[model samples]
Target: MSFIASIGQGAINLYHRIRWVVSISTAIVQLAFHPSSWTKPVRAVLTRQIVFTGYDAIGFVAVVALLTGISVVVQAQVWMGRLGQSELLGPLLVTVIVREVGPLLVNFIVIGRSATAMAAELAGMKVRHEVEVLDSQGLDPLVFLVMPRAISMALSVFGLAMLFVVFSFGSGYLCGAFLGTGPGDPGIFARSVVRGVSSYDFYNILAKTLIPGLLTGVIAANEGLSVEGVATDIPQAVTRTVVRATLAVLVVSVIVSVLTYI
Candidate 1:
C-alpha cells in the first residue's frame, strides 16, 4: 500500500507540473499578441534576450554544425557513391540534417547554454525579492519578465536552426570535396540539396524550432519563479528547468515528426 501510494503521488505531481507549464505557455502566447505587452522595457528585455541567447551562440553553434556536417555529410557521400546511388545523397542529407538533426541539436544546445542561465538568473531574482519589488511597483512580472524572454527564445531558436542548416551543409560540402568523396562540381552538390528540399521541410524546421523554443523558455521561467524566498532552492530550480525543458523539447519534436508522417 505504501509503495502504491508513493507512485500515485508522483503521478499527481507530474500531472500538476504539466498543467502549470501548459497554463503558463498559453498565457505567454496570448500576451505575445497584445500590442500593449511590447512596452519599451519589454522591448529592451526582448532585445537583450535575443542577443544573449541567439547572437552570442553563433560561434559555438557554427562549430558544432561544421563538425556534424563533416562527419554525416562525408559519410553519406562516400556510402552513396559506393552503392552507385549518389543521386540519393541530397535527399538523405536533407532528411537527416534539416528534418531531424538540425533543430534537435540546436534546441539541446540552447537548453544547456541559455536556458540554464535564464533559470538561474530568474531564480536569483526570486530569492532577492526583486520580483516582488517589480510587482509592487505596478510592473507585471509576466510582461516585463516572462513574455519577452519566451518570445525572444522562439525567434532565436528559429534563426539559429536556419544558420545551423546552412553551416552544416557548407562545411559538409567543403570537407567532402577536399576528401574527394563528393562531386567535383560545387553546383551539383548545391542542386542535390535543393532538390531534396520540399515545402514540408520548411514547415518541419519551423515547428521543431519555434514551438520547442517557446516551451523551453516558459519552462525555465516557470521553474525559476517557482522558487521560494529560500536561496538554497535556486540550484534545484535551475536543475528542474534543464530537465523539464529538455523533456518538453523532445516531446514537441516527436509530436511534430509524427504529424509530418501522418
Candidate 2:
C-alpha cells in the first residue's frame, strides 16, 4: 500500500507539471492570435515596464557594462601586446558587445528586476482574490493582464538590449582610448558594427530576449494562478515562479546559443 501510494503521488506530480506546461503554452498561442488582447490600453503596461525595466535599471547595467568593457580592453591589450596584434581590438570589442555582453546583461537585468516583480505582483493579486474578481466579472484575466505584461516585457527587453549594445560599445571605446589601448578609430568601430553582426545574429538576439520574456511572463502568471490555500502560498508561488522562470531562461539561452552557432 505504501509503494502504491508513492507511485500515485509521483503520477500526480507529473500530471500537475504537464498541466502547467500545457496551460501556459495554450495561453501563449491564444495571446498570439488575439490582437485585441494587446491593444491600446495595453500600451500603458508596456510603457510602465519600459520605465521600470529599462530606465530604472539602467544604472546597474551601465556600471556592469562599463567595468566589463574596461576589463576586456585591458586584458586584450595585455595579451595582444605580447602577440603583436593589438590592432585587433576593434573587431574583438565589436564581437564581445554584439555577440555576448549585450544580450547577457539585458537578460540579467530583466530577470532580476522586472521578472521577479511581475511574479510577485501577480501572485499577490491571486492571493487577494483580485484575479478571481476579474474572472467573476467575465473578464479574461490572461488577455487583460498576462498578455499585456508579456508583450511589454518582450518589447522592453529588445529595446533595452539594443541600448545596452550601444552604451557598452561606447563605454568600451572611451575607456580604451583613455587607457591608450584602443583602436582609436571610430570609423573602424562603426564599420565593424555594421559588418560583424549579420541579420541572423539580430534575429537570434531578438528571439533570445523576446522568448525568455514571454516564458518568464507566462510562467509567472501560471504560478500565480496555481496559488491556493492560505496567504503564505502567495509568496511561495512567487518564489517558485522566479526560480522556474530563471531556470527556463538559462536553459533556453543555452539552447538558442547552440542552435544559432551549431
- Please report the candidate that would top lDDT against the real structure: 1
Expressed as tens digits, the lDDT of each residue in 84-158 for candidate 2 is 876665556555666666776677678778777887787778778998888897667877678777766777777
Residue 65 lDDT in model 1? 96
Candidate 1: Cα lDDT at 24: 86
lDDT of candidate model 2 versus the reference = 0.73
lDDT of every model, 2 decimals = 0.93, 0.73
User: RMSD to native for every prediction?
Assistant: 1.0, 3.4
* TM-score versus the correct structure, for each prediction: 0.97, 0.83
What candidate 1 gets wrong by more than 4 Å, as runs, is none
Q: lDDT value for candidate 1?
A: 0.93
Tell me, by TM-score, which candidate is best.
Answer: 1
